[model samples]
Target: MTNFEEDISVYNFVSILGECFQNKASVNLVKHYPTGRMLAVKRFHLDKIWDNISIVQQEITLTKQLQHPNIITYYTSFVHGPEVFAVSPLQAFGSCKSLLDSHFNEGLPELAIILIFKDIIEAVNYLHKSGFIHRAIRASHILISASGKASLSGLHYACPLVINGRWQRAVHSFPLSTQPNLNWLSPELLEQNLKGYNEKSDIYSLGILCCELANGREPFADVDSTLMLVEKVRGCIPGLLDCTTLPSKCDDRECQGDCDIEISLSRRGFSQYLHEFCYMCLEREAKDRPSAAELLTHPVFTLVNKGISLPELLKPVLPLSDKVSPNKEMCHLDHVLHMSEMDMPSCDWDFPIS
Candidate 1:
């Protein structure tokens, strides 16, 4: 067996839940003592703890503040000497990566692809509405739960907003690392020309994640980080090798102008609506990209067949007694303003209700 499997055995783990990309952490499915309930333990080594403390803190803070079914639920956190750990519900199917790897050969059915993308977009829209930007969005960071639901994980790089009048900038202390995964970074981030990454960066990463989901491969799997950086600077978008066959003259060229032809051809599996969403997300100019709220209202998510507005589809039908209290509404608005300021947006929304 491999060293990883040996390590898993040593940990007395029931199963290896998932492997992280940077080797910074690992998630294991283990039986909790006494209760014997299954749980996911995210273990980060002591050596990387100092560098990752902010990340752990961010995860804790963000999870506590944002409550959504599609977002990964944080059960608890603990510290054992230099090592820090966070426990969440175990996902039986592992990550989106595992699913793609196992099913790629057979190809993903259209219904399955639609379901996955819908889940991911919902999670992302929730984060955006809550005033958080998930800087690291990739296939590995998305978990497929036992109930066949997709949940987003990893918020170490998430930026909280701090609103100052009509302007926003990311919280000052949570510094951007010199080395970030360039493969999934947007063009503005690669050039370091962008002052702050707002919701749009998350959108760009989502586009890459969509590419991975449809093709069963990482968007730029073969390219090294440096080359990926170079390619991104030259406006070279990544393409997919595997795609579902479509009828002739499908006109999948909806997202054509954003990148080189190679990238466009690879995205044939995506519908025109999905293509447009990805294109808006991958826009080189941040201002050109759609907001999370806007994305939630897109035709891909709208209940067009039923003639229902996007908001109507997302509206909760709870009884009046369970409606949001005035105090809670104020708190949520305050949080949104704070987030908008940190994002450094030109204007902030002043809700009429407030």
Candidate 2:
């Protein structure tokens, strides 16, 4: 038997869960041989770490330092022959993006959205205060538990925003080119003219992510990444509203003849506080955007008070079913095929959420 299979024998490989592109990690659901506890294991093939060892190492280092309710718990990591592994609690609900794609294809209830966003912003704020910048803040990086509590994941792109207790303005090197999905990146990152992006870049992504949650798809879905970069550089912004938020009827059809009735109605339909908060995050100029801490106080978050309870929040969304059957090999192959067909990018600026 191959060393990979030999090492993995300690656990019953139930199924494949997901991937971590930067670290060359494939998350798998496995049952511990000893206690029979099920866990998600992110296996990183060391063969791919020739020179990029630091990138994978950074994820392990940063994750070990993080301890928060909304951040994924890093259980343990160990090298096993040709590969390395980082184990964490299984997120039965999967990522927000996957869940949205599968179940809530039209977008979630506003209360649910607010609850998820609140947890995310709070986690991000904690990270920033602890001197880290979760450069990636997309929907795919947000993992939901069976209880419906959201936690941030995908920390491979994370880096320190502060140095020696002071916030730094620029980074010395460019991010890896293999990283895909530049559509969610901020203008500062795409332009590459600015010294470098900082924490504010994440807020911009958060704004886009909010729109994604509302629309059930990525923004600029029809545009090419290169063209999207041009528009962002040219000061163009995406509309936050989608069909779900717009009104079905327009009373005044005459005066609204030239005006976009849906757009007008959507504007009025959105929660004023939430809309304004999202607008603040999408500010073109990085400095104009509010920091994570400042955003926590926005009316959208503050007014929610005690949001939906975890049990209630999880009820509408069922846990991801185990597709595994008697033929384990076929189940694994099926998962690989399913993942390959997804339009989700290989790497899109991951920031820590859980």
Candidate 3:
């Protein structure tokens, strides 16, 4: 019997539900036959793992050690012949990127953005405390739940940001075979370096992600990766808020009057604070950037009204995703533009590497 069949026979797991990320890992919808508790079983084929066995083992090791409210829960994992299976609570709402594509195309509301980032910041802070850096932080890596809670995902690129309990600079020599989303990489990480980068690099990527959430797209996604690297090293920042629109009172699509102009001016001020928040995240100096813990308490996050829940914002659009196929081509080019055409085991998870 195949590894998958053996796992099913031993664990009594249900069938596959969906597949996501560039890795093509199957997200299986399973249930504990005894208790009927639902689960998301992620199956990674061992044959495909090949030489990356150590990385996969590390991913499982690191995931097992993490426990945070904003981080996805890693229930358990086991090897069944040639396959490894990780089980966690299924996020029915899918990824934040899928939400953006299906709904909220104009960008999330300021309050919603603040709440989501606050959760993400808390998760990143926890990771830093554990002495690791989530090298890749992006909208696609942030998964949302039916309850509207946002958790950080994509831990495959995770590595030690500190050594012997001391924060240290580490450099990575990117392999020509693999292409990453260069826009999210901090300037220091993109440079030819011997000193390398640290947890602060994750902070830089967080800043870019904030802009992405506010604008409903990855920043500088249209530029070629090589050119992006040069621009980043030159202290160029992504124009995250430049394209954002202010909340308007006009019910109609088209309106022209002194009242409309007055309304525009009044509403423009609403996003000013959010713009400043993004600016704080996009600071050119990594040292100048606030730590994840510090950013959690920023004034911008205070804008989230306790009375309003993020689920309300996601309710309308979440159901729309059920009708669409995950493999269906995204109509928006900007959403997937940063993703390379190459085929490799893509990794991004709030819990274990996906």
Q: What is the Å distance of residue 162 in model 2 from its true position? A: 3.4
* Model 3, span 215-257: residue lDDT tens: 6677776788888878888888764443244344656646556
lDDT of 1 by residue, 69-177 (tens): 8888766666655455666666655566555555442234434555566777798888876777777777767766555567777666676655653435433332365
Candidate 1 lDDT for residue 251: 50
Whichever of 1 and 2 has more TM-score, that candidate is 2
Off by over 4 Å in 2: 1-10, 22-24, 49-51, 163-166, 177-179, 243-269, 302-307, 310-316, 321-354
lDDT of 3: 0.66
Candidate 2 local lDDT, 1-354, one digit each (tens)? 112233455666665555566535567677666665666777666776657678778777888888999998767778777677776777777788876777666555566778888899989999887877776777888887777778987676777777787778665344564245466778887777757777788889888888788667767877877888888888786655644456555677685752463454354345677678778888888899999989888878665557556446545656644443445542243454365346554322222322
- Candidate ranking (lDDT, best to worst): 2, 3, 1
What is candidate 1's local distance difference test score? 0.56
- The RMSD (Cα, Å) of candidate 3 is 8.4
Candidates in order have lDDT scores of 0.56, 0.69, 0.66
Order of all candidates by TM-score, from best down to worst?
Answer: 2, 3, 1
In model 1, the runs with Cα more than 4 Å from the true position are 1-13, 18-21, 33-36, 45-48, 80-83, 105-107, 163-180, 224-227, 237-270, 302-354
**Whose lDDT is greatest here?**
2
Q: Which should have the higher lDDT, number 2 or number 3?
A: 2
Candidate 3: list runs displaced more than 4 Å.
1-17, 164-166, 169-178, 242-270, 319-352
